[model samples]
Target chain A: MQYPEAIAKLIESYSKLPGIGRKSATRLAFYTLGMSDDDVKNFARSLSASKSDLTFCRICGFITSKDDDPCVICSDESRDQSKIFVVENSQDEMAIENTHDYHGLYHVLNGVLSPMEGRGPEDINITSLITRLSDHSEVKEVIIGLDASTEGEATTLYLARLIRPSGIKVTRLARGLSVGTNVDYADQLTLTQAVNGRTEI
Target chain B: MQYPEAIAKLIESYSKLPGIGRKSATRLAFYTLGMSDDDVKNFARSLSASKSDLTFCRICGFITSKDDDPCVICSDESRDQSKIFVVENSQDEMAIENTHDYHGLYHVLNGVLSPMEGRGPEDINITSLITRLSDHSEVKEVIIGLDASTEGEATTLYLARLIRPSGIKVTRLARGLSVGTNVDYADQLTLTQAVNGRTEI
Candidate 1:
């Protein structure tokens, strides 16, 4: 009374994604079967391309084509070379990029430090950021734009301590109430940070 | 800024899955990128294998290996040849098979009648079901195990009308308040059905 071997394998693959369980995986696997032959092939191609065709930037650790090792951000002379915006993931970089608020170059940390899981600086893209800074004397500042989670804080503190010795200015992203979040619904820690970091209009 | 071409393609591919929006697709695509090369290759292999290495059963319309045309259940000599349990999907068939209460072959309709979606009798696996019934003289009963939704009811009614002329007994799954459902929380229609179908136990 088991699903066909191919379908079961597909279901297991789908289950590996975040937020997908066995039931959801079954739903996804069946739906995949209903896709056109071209679509199925294309989906498979995209999956392989995401892994095989893309590589981390040698300079900034962001995702780029296999041929573009240093990535466009690292190579772009028009961007602000004096500042590097460091993030835990490329999605955060995209979030900031979409806003058109920052023009500096980027450094993807890939992941945050999590001692609970035994993930340390060596496990993420931290080494490359240090190397990039050391190799580029024009860089004046490193802006840590990691998430506001405990692990993010730990990574930021570690990175700050690591970079502060070189006399290059280092700053972490501001922690306060998120935009559009109601004060009454805000958590205690956020409210305290909001009060402590209030700026005059 | 747009994501790199490969990552963007992966996101679009992931977005095609059920219940997965652009945000969730982005998360899944990035997660796939983080997977080991071997795991990613296996995931891609499963996606392609689900399409290439498997096909629908010629008789029951259930999924099977490419080489097994009629599928295991349809070809099984041990099962009850007098009964055919009709279901909307293989998942429904698996749900029934898990209970070990039924010992009949299954005919997967692939989809139920959904007029709003422009799906008709021809759009589903209905024609094959009729053909299977005509070819097999031993099938005396067809238990319609479709969902109890409007579309399911429509399909059941359509199939029942179509097969009634052949002198075969056409039955449907009973509708009532589900097991473990609280009486007070049951919907009006379920309560009505439960009352109307109540029997001495």
Candidate 2:
């Protein structure tokens, strides 16, 4: 009782996506079948267009249109170029930018150093970041805004060791219990950081 | 601080799918971008191809390729043409086929009677089913294999009322508590059906 070849192929394609299992994929395939021909074309086109039409920003590694190589953040003159926030990827950059508190430009590393996963310093987009820092003497500080994971910590230390020798101030995102998280439920590492990094009210 | 237009479009498309929300869509969009160009093209091709290449079986309403008008079940000479299992959609038809117990042909109603949703008798693929029964005097029994919803009950009653006058037998799936379900935890309706439909071993 196998499904038709088209349905089976579409289900397999959908199942490749994160968080989608075979059952969910089947549901998606059936739903796609119900869509109008125009909608189906647009849906399929978007999958390919999202990948082909976008490219990494040459200067910052943030994703942008193929025509915008330096990206909007790097080209904007009003942003504080002196404070460069180095994040793990474009999504992290977006999350930070959404806060609207940091008016500094960003540098996306594309990925963190994961030695266990065979991802090392060379695997990520680090060379361009170093070159950007050396080229812009106005950039006085490098803020490592990576996740609070082992790989993020390793990447932060690795970048700090490299950038600090050039007389540039190096810092990292403040580690503490997240806002809206109950103190009782906070993990041990976060609680310890919150205690150690206590500031005046 | 918007995601690139292509990325945003892909995310929107993923979000439109059932069971996927904004967070899941974002994750899927990023995963799609990470896929190889050939894989992405294949994935997109499957979406459009599944929609355009497959169509409804003209006789049974089951989804099939364009060339298979009557579908595999309807055209099979070995199957019992005298008994027809009426289901809501192709998914149900597949589910029933998976059991490997029934050898009768199927008639897909496309949808059940959902008057609350403004769906009437004409809204679903019922006309063709009635025409098939009228055209084939060999179909002596009609088995309603719809879901156990109020709409399913209404549709079963409606179909039985129409086909019973033709001197054909009309039956529905047995109603009772499912196997392995805890009797203590069963809902009132199921418990009631279990009591009413109780049988001796």
Per-candidate TM equals 0.94, 0.93
Candidate 1 on B113-199: residue-level lDDT in tens?
898999999989999889989999999999998888888888888999999999999998887878899999999999999899887
Most DockQ-accurate candidate: 1
Chain A TM-score per candidate?
0.94, 0.95
Q: Model 2, range A94-127, lDDT digits (tens) per residue? A: 9999999999989998899997999988889889
Candidate 2: which stretches are off by over 4 Å? none
Q: Per-residue lDDT for B1-201 in model 2, tens only?
A: 898899999888888888889988888888888998988998998888887789999999998887777788888999999999999988899999999999999999889999899999999989998999999999999999999988999999999999898999999999987889998999999999989989999
Angstrom error of the Cα, residue B121, model 1: value is 1.9
What i-RMS does each candidate reach, in Å?
Answer: 0.9, 1.2
Model 2: pairs clashing at backbone N, Cα or C within 3 Å: none
lDDT of 1 by residue, A77-126 (tens): 89999999999888898898899989999999888999999998899998
